[model samples]
Target: MKKDNKLKLNLQAILTDLLIWIYILGCVSFLVNHWFEKIIQTNFVVIFGVAAGFISFILGLSIGRKIFLPTIKTEGKWYKTFWGWSVFLLLLITFIVGWNLVEVDLYKLFAKFQNAGGIMKGIFNPNMDIFMQCLAALAETIYLALLATAFAIPLAFFLSFFAARNLMPQTFLGNTVYIIVRTIATIFRSIEAIVWAIIFSVWVGIGPFAGMLALMIHSIASLTKLYSEQIENINPGPVEAIKATGANTIQTWIFAVVPQIISPFLAFTIYRWDINVRMATIVGFVGGGGIGLLLLQQQQMLRWQNVGIIIWMIAIVVWIMDMVSAKVRGKLQEM
Candidate 1:
């Protein structure tokens, strides 16, 4: 029995390693193909990608075994181990690649400093004439964020229970529900609100309504993730006690889970509101309506003073929201 158990564990480890290698191979191959296809100008690009991926897989296996296998002693200096060297190499490679990809050049910044003088001067002397107009737009931005958060709260609250692994029943149906809810939330959350805003702008026309919808959808996904995680971290003591009383799943959640998560949920919701407020400005650049749209217009026309006014207003409003949300979340934590 002991031998058989050891064999089983070995098989499982091997299978897991194979799967990880396969994933790495696929990603490396795709990246190689994408970046070299045009330059290579031949079917050899595909072959090169495959070769690169194979080499990467072999190296990965070697490094993984050296770092993880029990044959390596843990008492030595970290830099003397394979793991430390691997990390150093990884970071060095990443920095080199990132620098090339972003085309970093410090010389141009200093050389072009004088070109921005007009813009800086205008920003320093903001046009107060458009103060009322910018204020109204800022108000609309605030309201848009507020409405999105308000509408998302109940839906997110409803879906989070289904997403929480510990809260779901240990049955096929329960597992299916958990997977489906989690998948939907992840898919939506992966998409930025600005992208959603672009889609909705085309669907519902360019206005605050479209922006509100975009923010609402994103908020629902974000809040569901936060709420589910909070539920998962709750004390098992309350849960077991509720189960001992012959309570059903719903009753268990209501009695054992809800109370513990309420304060954290409120705090998370307030944090989301603060996030939405900031996102609202970004979405507006894509015709989602708000001060960002106004800022975009002034920028395009090179009306730097007016743009400065809008920027200041947005900064002020964001700062105020940040302070208010912080205070509210602090109070909730105390509760």
Candidate 2:
């Protein structure tokens, strides 16, 4: 039986190695064909290339398994192992392909550096005339983020218990509800606030309201995930103790779960608010409203100095929000 088990393990390892070699051969063949087709231009060359690649891979794998692999195993250096080298080569190939696909040109950046001088100058010397206007816009941005966070908190707080694995009942109905809620949250979270902003902008006819809706939707999804994960990690002892008293599902959560997660929940909410404020500026670029719209206008009109002022205002507001959120989260952690 032990010999049979050893043979099974050896077969599995060989199968895995074969599959990996086939995958590598396929990728390399595709790349070689793509790059050389334009230059070589013949079926004979393509066929020969593939055949050569297959033979080379088989030979290398056999030789490596016999000699190189054992040498690397003795060396105890991961970088010298076949798998490590494979990963490094894969990353190198990906980088090379990606660089070509993107048409990266460092020369153009340096050549056009002088074109940005005027804009840079304007940014450095901000137009103070529009300071009040930008401040008002910045205020709108802050409030938009605040309202979104406030609205999402209660809904997320309610949904979290259902989404949490530990809190959900072990029955079929409870499992279904858990899955549905978690799937919906994941779908909503996967869609960025910017995309939601675009959709809402069209529906709501473009403004801070659209931005607010976008931020709120994203916040609800994000907070639900955070809140549920926190619930899952809570001390099971309190939960089991509460269940021992013949409490129902809801009571078990309220008495045992809520108390533990409140601090972390508050902290997560505050941190999310900070994120929303930064995102609000981006949402505005899509006409979701706030200082971003004003900044966009100035930029399009080449009013770099005005754009500079808006940028500074955004920077100041974001910095302040960051500091406040950090302090709030710190306090909550202490509690």
For all predictions, the C-alpha RMSD in Å is 4.8, 4.8
- Segments of candidate 1 deviating more than 4 angstroms: 1-61, 67-91
- Tens digits of lDDT, candidate 2, 1-335: 97786666545544555544454544555567667853443454545544544454454433224333343233446476545565566577666666766778999888999899878988899999998899888888989999999999999999998999987889999899999999999999999999999999999988899999999999999999999999999999999999999999789888998999999999999999999999999999897899988988999999989988888889988999999999999999999
What C-alpha lDDT do the candidate models reach, one value each?
Answer: 0.82, 0.83
Worst 10 residues of 2 by lDDT: 63-72
* TM-score for all models, in order of appearance: 0.81, 0.81
Q: For residues 55-148, what per-residue lDDT tens digits would candidate 1 score against the true structure? A: 5434543344443344534556658764456456556655655665687899988898999887897889999999999988888888999999
lDDT of 2: 0.83
Q: How far is candidate 1 from the true structure (C-alpha RMSD, Å)?
A: 4.8
